[model samples]
Target: MHSIVFIGGGNMASCIIGGMIDQGFDPLTLGVSVPSEQSKERLSKAYNIAVTSNNNDAIANADIVVLAVKPQIMRNVVLALAPALPKNAVIVSVAAGITVESLQSWLGSPRAIIRAMPNTPSLVRTGATGLFANDQASQLQKATVSSIFEAVGYCCWVESEALINAVIAVSGSGPAYFFQILDIMQSVGQELGLPEREARKLASQTALGAAQMAINSDQSPSELRDQVTSPGGTTERALNTFRNEGLESIFRQAMNSALARAEEMSKDFSA
Candidate 1:
C-alpha cells in the first residue's frame, strides 16, 4: 500500500479519507495535516489516522500527496510543503481551477501530478469524479489515481485539462443543482396538501428511484423520460409548461455561467 498524505483536513479531505478507510485502505498509511488543533483532533478521532499540525510532517514519507487545500491558498501551501515531498511521489490535486502547471511551479520542480474533481457524495461512496494527468505521470500512476476515486464512487479520466472545467460545471457543482430542485419539489408537495415529512420522503424516494432506473436501464435518459410522458396526459402538460418556460435554456445558461466562472478562477490562480 502506498503512503498517502492529505495536506488539508477539511470537508473534502475528510470525505476522501473516510471513504478510503471504509474501502479497507490501510489507515495506518494515511496522514492528514490541519492548522487548527480542533480540526486535527476531529480527524484523528474520526478516522484513526495520523494527524499533524505541521504540513511537512505529513508529507515527509508520502508516496502520494493529495493537495486538498482551497485553490486560493494552494500555491502557498504547495511551496511550503515542496521541500518535504519525496522526490518520486505523485501529487494529486482535488482543488478546482488549480492547474498542474501552477502546482509544478510552486513545487519548483517537475513532478508527476494528477488533477481530480470529486463531488461531496463521496462521503456516501456514491460520488462521481473526473481526472486528468500530466505527461510526467505514468500509466501505473493514473491507474492508482483511478482506483482511489473508484473506491468512493464512479471515476473517468478526461483527455484534456479543459474538460476539468466542464467537470466543475457538471459534477462539482451538480449536487447543489440537484438539491435545489429537490427542495423546490418537496416544498411544492407540501403545498399540495401532504405533510412536510411525508412530502419530503415522497420527493426524495422518487428522485432516488428515477436515478436508479436511469442507471439500470440501457435506454437513454431522454428515451426513459419520453416513455413516462404519455400523449395528452398530465406529464405531457407539465412538460409543455417547462418547454414554454424555457427550462432547458435556463439550465444551459446556468451551467455556462458555472463553466465561465471556473475558467475565470483558473486564470486568476495561474502562476
Candidate 2:
C-alpha cells in the first residue's frame, strides 16, 4: 500500500510529488492516478512511480488521498472514489473554491478531510498554503497534512473558512500581481530607451533583491521604502507619483474584490 495517492497528475500535483520525493520519500511509495494515458506515462516516467487511470485502484491501498483535480471535476472524482476508499483514509483536497463541507457531502458523509489552497509558486518550492481541516481530522492527520504542505513551501492554518478567501487574495493571487509590476517596470524601461534584455535583467533582479531584503530585514516594507527614497531621488519621485495615484488603495481594493469572487465561487460550489 502506497502512503500517498494523488488523483491528478497536473502541474500542482507534479510539484507536490516532486517535493515529496526530494524530501527523501521513496518514489515507489507514491501513486498517481491521471485520466489521460499521456499524463500517466509522463508522471510515471518523470517521478518513477506507479500510475493508473482508476481512482479507486489508486486510493484502494493508500492512507492519504490527495484530490488535486480542478474544482469543476472534484465532485465526480470524489463520488467515484468514495465507495472504494478505506474507511479511515484521510482525504486532502487542493481544489480552489471548494469547501470541506461540500467535499464531505459529495463523498457521502462528514469524513476526515483537509481543504488546502496552495499557490502556483509551489513549483519553485516557495509557495504559501492555507489549510483548514474538518473536526474529523485527528492531531496526527493534521500534522501530516501540514508537513506535506511545508515540504513544498510554507503552510499556515486558518481559523475560519472565510479567512481562506483572504488567503486566496493575498498569497494565492499575489504572484500574478507581482508579475504585473515586473511587466510594467520592463515596459517603462523600454520606453526610456533601455535595451529589452538589459531592462528585463535589471527589473527582475531588482524585484528579487527587494523581496529578499523584505524577507531578511527586521524593518517594515514601508520603512524599507522610506530608506530607499532619499529627498529629490529618482525613487522618491516614483514613490510620490504612486502615492498621488492612490496605489496602495488600488491594491487593497483589488485584493478585496478577489476575496469576494472567491467567496462567490465557494457559494456556487456549495449550492
Candidate 3:
C-alpha cells in the first residue's frame, strides 16, 4: 500500500482523512503531522492513524504528502519538509490560493505538486474539490489524488490553472451563497407565520431536495425551474420578482468578486 501523510490536522485535513478511512483505506497507511497536541490526539483517535507533531518524520517515507496547512504558513512548512520529503512523493496541497509554482519554488526541488480546492462540505462527505497539477505530475499521480479527494465528495480536474480560480468562485465559495439564500428563506418563512424551528427545517430540506433533483434529473436546472413554474403561479411570480430585482446580475458580481480575490491571493502567496 502506498503511504499517505497529511501535514496538517485542521478541520479540512481531518474531514478528508476521515472520509479516506470511511472508504476502507487502511489506517496503517495513513499518517498526519500536526503541531497541536489536542489535534494530534483527536485525529489519532478519530481515524486510528499515526499522528505526530514532527512534520519531517511524519512524511519521511510517505508516497503522497498532503499539505493541508493554511496558505500563509505553507511556504515555511514546505521549506522545512523539503529536505526530508521522499524524492518521488507527490505533494497535494488542499490549501487554497497557492499555486504549483510557488510550492515547487519553496521545495527548492522539482517535485510533482498538485493544488486542490476542497469545500467545507467535505466534513459531511459531500464536498466538491477542484484539482490542478504541474507538468511534472503523471497520470497515475493525478488518478491517486483524484481518488483521495473523491473519497470526501465529487472531485474533478481543470486543464488550466486559471480555471482553479473559477472553481474557487463556483464551488469553493458556493456553499456560502446557498447558505445565505437558505437564511433569507428561513427568515421570511418565520415572518410568514411559520415557527422558527419549522421554518429552518423547511428551508434546509427544500434546498437539499432541490440539489438532489438538480443532480439526478436529466434536465438542467433551468428546465426543471420552468417545468415547476406555471402561468401566473406563485413560483413564477416569485421568480419574476427575483429577475426584476436583477438577482442574476447580483450573483455574477458576487462570484466575480470571489474569483478576483482568489486571483489576488495567488499573487500574494506567489510573492
Candidate 4:
C-alpha cells in the first residue's frame, strides 16, 4: 500500500480521510500534518493514524501528499515542505483557483502534480470532482489520484487544463444553481396556501426524489420531462412560462459567467 499524507486536517481533508478508511485503505498508511495540537489530536483520535504539527516530518516516507491547506498559504507551505518530499512522491492539491504552473514553480524542481476541483457536496460524499495532472505525473500516480476522489463520489479526468474551467462552470458551481431552484420552490409553495414547514419538506423531498429518479432511470432528462408535460396541463403551463421567459438562455449566461470568473481567478494566480 502507498503511504498517504495530508498537509491539513480541515473539513475537506477529513472527508477524504474518512472516505479512504471506509473503503478499507490501511489506517497505518495514512498520516496528517496540521498547525494545531487540537487538530492533531482530533485526527489521530478519529483515525488512529499519525498526526503531527510538523509538515515535513509527516511526509518523510510518503508516496503521496495531499495539499489541503488554504490557497492563500499554499505557496509558502509548499516551498517549506518541498525539500523534504520523497523523490517519487505525487502531490495532489484541492485548493481552488491555484493552477498547476504555480505549484510546479513553487516546488523548484520537477514533480508529479495534480489539480483537483471538488464542490461543497463532497462533504456529504455525493460530490462530483474534476481532475487534471501535469505531464510529469505517471499513469500510476494518476490512477492513485482517481481512486482517492472516487472513494468520496463521482470523479472524472479532463483532457486539458482549460476544461477544468468548464468543470468549474458545471459541477463545481452546479450545486448552487439547484439550491437556488429549491429555495424558490419553497418560497412559492408557502405562498400557495401551504404551511411553511410542510412546504419546505415538500420542496426538499421532491428535489431528492426527482434526483434519484433521474439518476436511477435509463431515460434522458428531457425525455422524462416531456413525459410529465401533458397536453393542456398545469405542468405544461408553468413550463411554457419558463420557456417564454428564456430560462435556458438565462442559465447559459449564468454558467458562462461562472466560467469566466474561474478563468479570471486562475489568471490571478498564474504568476
CA lDDT of each prediction against the hidden true structure = 0.92, 0.90, 0.92, 0.91
Candidate 2 clashes: the total is 0
lDDT value, residue 167 of candidate 3? 96
lDDT of 2 by residue, 1-271 (tens): 7878999989999999988888888887899999898998899889999899999988888878999999998888888888998988899989888998888888897689888899999999989999988889898989988888987998999988788898999999999999999999999999999999999999999998998899899999999999988999999998899999999999999999999999999988882
Instruction: List, residue by residue over 1-271, the lDDT tens digit for candidate 1.
Output: 2389899989889988888888888899899999999999999999999999898888888888999999889999998999888988999999988998899899999999999999988878889999999999999889878888988899999999999999999999998999999999999998999999998999889988998999899999999999999999999999999999999999999999999999998999999
Better of 1 and 3 by TM-score: 3
Evaluated with TM-score, which candidate comes out highest? 3
Error of 4 at 97 (Å): 1.1
Q: For candidate 4, what is the TM-score?
A: 0.95
Error of 2 at 63 (Å): 1.7
Model 2: how far is 164 from its true place, Å?
Answer: 1.1
Give the local distance difference test score of model 4: 0.91
After TM-score superposition, the amount by which residue 223's alpha carbon in candidate 1 deviates from its true location, in angstroms, is 0.8
* Candidate 3 clashing pairs, residues 3+ apart or interchain: none
Worst 10 residues of 1 by lDDT: 1-10
> If the candidates were sorted by their lDDT against the true structure, best first, what order would they fall in?
3, 1, 4, 2
Residues 1-271, candidate 4: write the lDDT tens digits: 3389999999999999998898888999999999998998899899888888999999999999999999888889999999999999999999878888888888889899999998878888888999999899999999988998988889999999888899999999999999999899989998998898998899889988888889899999899899989999999999999999999999999999999999988887663
Shift of residue 80 alpha carbon in model 1, Å: 0.7
Ranking by TM-score: 3, 1, 2, 4
At residue 241, give the lDDT of candidate 1: 97
